[model samples]
Target: MLLLFLSVLLTLIYCSHGDLIADTCRKTQYPLICISTLRSNPHSRSADVKGLVRFILKAALGKANTILNLANDLLKKTKDPILRQSLDTCISVYQDALDEIPIAIENVGKNNVEASDNASATFVDADTCEESFSNSPFAADNKAVKQLAVVAEDIIGSLG
Candidate 1:
């Protein structure tokens, strides 16, 4: 009877431990999938895509800030010159990447607003500006904005 009780107790603990491990793994994969989907659908105008991109960008920026804090903590905790230098470099690169996101987003917003304004100004029978706007430099800038989001994701992964 004693042996059976011990075995049952151990089995229950092992099962709980496995559950904890699985939950952690799931959490980690969730963020990766979320980021990847955002990066892939950055150009989408659908509400879902836009919301996902905004959420992912916010998450990425938050993570980047956390890394910066970690680097600062490491600077205080470690005396190794090489490690310190590497951490400094990581912080600098992360800052640059984060800084670029705002500019990219702003450019995209400006382009979209300008495009809408231009489209509205055209006479009901005028299609020339509408057609030209579709292929304008602003459209190309929109593509670049999406690419920048993907790059930001990559940068966040590297920082991690």
Candidate 2:
């Protein structure tokens, strides 16, 4: 009887990919983003909670890098000194985000609680970058990075 119960429990824990993804996403603050992003990745089908957190952090890092590139390009093209200063600040923040996200991913993979703090730092970096482009063409891009970073932090925090 005990063996049978253990088998059933294992089945539930390692159920269909959709079941795992849906259940995990529901626990996150942004269910839609969590579900969609996890489902889009083939590896998420077999990944557990820590793996999911790593996936989110990596995705956030990619967005940060993209935002950094956009800021750099805009800075090169713009002539306004004030706008240039804002872009420079944004570029720096994005760079910091790029550094923090990888550390978060690594720590999460190791099951270390410090991952949450690193994720929070990335969110701050994204938030700071977004503030620099409040009324500029890159505002949307910055906002997207901020959202991704927030989602990453939320997922990391959920792990605890």
Candidate 3:
């Protein structure tokens, strides 16, 4: 009897895990990235949609801040006007990304059902930074920013 109970319990656990993450990930463009990113977070194991969105947005905000700090650091290393201009622009992009996050969080909290998509700045801010450095010597600076932004946007889309 205990063995039978254990089998059913294990089965339920396996199915719920799929339903919580994998099934939700299916709704996004980057399902593999979504599953991998969310699953890596300790809080995600029991997170519902709002909790998942909050975790993802917070992570993305952290990445945006990192990008901002990296750009500021790069600015300190150079006196070149062109490089400084590019870095400043990239920094602004990350700042915008950071600013948008709070609004997205609030919109998610509203539970409007349609607000999350419209509320998102998504990958636009990151894309701007990436494009600014695409032909510059600062392409290396854009790498992490672009990757994190894409992951953030994908996760946000999955929420809706």
Better model by lDDT, 1 or 3? Answer: 3
* Worst window of 10 by summed lDDT in candidate 1: 121-130
| Candidate 3 residue lDDT tens string, 26-81 | 66655675677778897786777766666666666777777788889999999989
List, residue by residue over 60-157, the lDDT tens digit for candidate 1. Answer: 44544555566577668878776666666545645554564444334333344432222222111122211333232223322333333443333233
Q: What is the lDDT of candidate 1?
A: 0.42
lDDT of each: 0.42, 0.77, 0.66
Of the candidates numbered 2 and 3, which has the greater lDDT value?
2
Q: Model 3 Cα displacement at 144 (Å)? A: 6.4
Model 2 per-residue lDDT tens digits across residues 1-160: 9999999988876676569678777876777877777778888878987888788777777778887898899888999998898889888988888888888888885655678788888878877776775476666666665666666667667666
What TM-score does each of the candidates earn?
0.41, 0.83, 0.75
On TM-score, the stronger of 1 and 2 is 2
Ranking by lDDT: 2, 3, 1
How far out, in Å, is residue 14 in model 2?
8.1
Listed per model in order, the count of residue pairs whose N, CA or C atoms clash below 3 Å is 0, 0, 0
Give the Cα RMSD of candidate 1: 18.6
